[model samples]
Target: MAIGPSAVERWLDLSTEELRAQVKQLVAARLPGDHSVWQAIRRHPALVPRIRGVLSGLAASAAGSKDEAMQKVWISKARSALDQEYVAPVKAARKPVVKEEPVPEPEPVIELKEPEPQQKQPHKAIPTMLFQEPS
Candidate 1:
């Protein structure tokens, strides 16, 4: 069955539990070996329902075809739908993007100064005498 925008919107309106259930059903029906998708659904229990309609539609479409090629095609379509509807959008939303402008380097400045003449200090002569025996 073809999933339209309205169907997706309706799925988006479903409760978290309902969505989770829908995804669980889809996993059981169409993706038994897809542990990663199952793990992701469990991890983001809240997000699973968001793609329920697409996945459900894909699963339904794949249900009629017993051909291995057609089943593979449906699985691929479901995977893409899950990525587009759920994974990619969430990843994009969660990514922290920092936009920074390149700053221009500052030019170095050098200053020239004249050297001052050194001042001579008067030196005191050391006391010649060793301490006289204290009288």
Candidate 2:
């Protein structure tokens, strides 16, 4: 696309003095949060543009580095640090309470006996008398 007169005017209108002032204001507005970098970024609209600029600069720096291996290492470390900062701590589980059932005791056994005595029978002798008759 051609740089039309209007586009040129728009570009010229962006004052260098104003840009510098905005950048300074951004640096002052920036603050850190306990959870994440974005948490801080989302709170301050003035700092958001500045932070994006810094991140873009970092990416450009990484891309420009002579050693691709070193650039990858730096990127990996940055990602791991960001991940560790926002992760919440895990809580321990509590032990469950168990109810015990009560068992009933067994009843005692009773023994029965007869106390009455049995009567004994007495013996009796029978006598027979026999007489001879004369013819």
Candidate 3:
């Protein structure tokens, strides 16, 4: 059967590259946005490469139903993304410390208190424990 106008129109509306780009963008956006989907996609051993291939192929294709479906999926993803507010985590502001007022200097009072000289004590020899009797 020949391709219908609606199908042709949809395909004409979005090129294969455009569709692929849409899918890639959607995946990128959703990967970070949705934890579950991202985890699932990441946890899947085979899905990762297959998904990459599919998305890359979708992006590279010039015309196909897959591309059209991806375009719609991208549109839905875009809509959901638009509805949410993208707020970055707020950082704490640093506060400037206030300087304290300087106090007046006090008058110098001289007090003579002589320190006693220290007496030298006799040195004692330390006892050593020799393992080999000091050969």
Candidate 4:
């Protein structure tokens, strides 16, 4: 029988151990976002680490799976949940940098310019063929 969103509570209703197993199987079937579990996960994000564990196991299994690319998609989905579905981890606040006056840039040490062309001069060879007599 096809399960609907309204029926999700029935699926989710189980003992703690049973629920974990069911959630594992559900995540294995598809992305957590594709199911109502995402809503529950949003409500109780402590489940993220467990989900991540399952995803990591899935990633390892993907190595031997014929559809490795598809398995990578699951990994992407897991990362997306961590990045987008929840608040980011707290980062250490950076200390304010002391303001220092800007120093003027220094002039270049070397300058380059195109070489000037030299004027053509007549060569003093063979007296410029002057007084050309019989060869």
- Model 1 residue runs over 4 Å out of place are 12-65, 85-135
Deviation from native of the Cα of residue 74 in model 3, angstroms: 9.1
Displacement of residue 98 (Cα, Å) in model 2 is 2.7
Any runs in candidate 2 off by more than 4 Å, and if so which?
1-55, 80-85, 97-135
Candidate 1 overall Cα lDDT vs. reference?
0.53
Candidate 3 stretches with Cα past 4 Å from truth are 1-29, 62-135
How close to the true structure is residue 46 of candidate 4, measured as C-alpha lDDT? 58
Q: Root-mean-square deviation of each candidate, in angstroms? A: 15.4, 28.4, 13.9, 12.3
Q: Candidate 1 or 2, higher lDDT?
A: 1
Q: Ten consecutive residues with minimal summed lDDT in candidate 3?
A: 1-10
Backbone collision tally, model 4: 0
Q: Candidate 1: TM-score? A: 0.25
Query: Where does candidate 4 have its weakest 10-residue lDDT segment?
Result: 1-10
TM-score of each: 0.25, 0.26, 0.27, 0.41
Better of 2 and 4 by TM-score: 4
lDDT of 1 by residue, 1-135 (tens): 222233333544667666645554554456533344544553454555555454556556566566646655645655654554333334445768799999998988978889899999989889887777888
In the range 36-71, model 2's lDDT, one tens digit per residue, is: 443433444454454345444455655856865554
Clash pairs detected, candidate 3: 16-61, 20-59
- State residue 81's C-alpha deviation in candidate 4, in Å: 2.9
Worst 10-residue lDDT window for candidate 1 reads 1-10
**Whole-model alpha-carbon lDDT for candidate 3:** 0.49
lDDT tens per residue, model 4, 52-99: 665676677678778898768767775575555644347999999999
TM-score of 2: 0.26
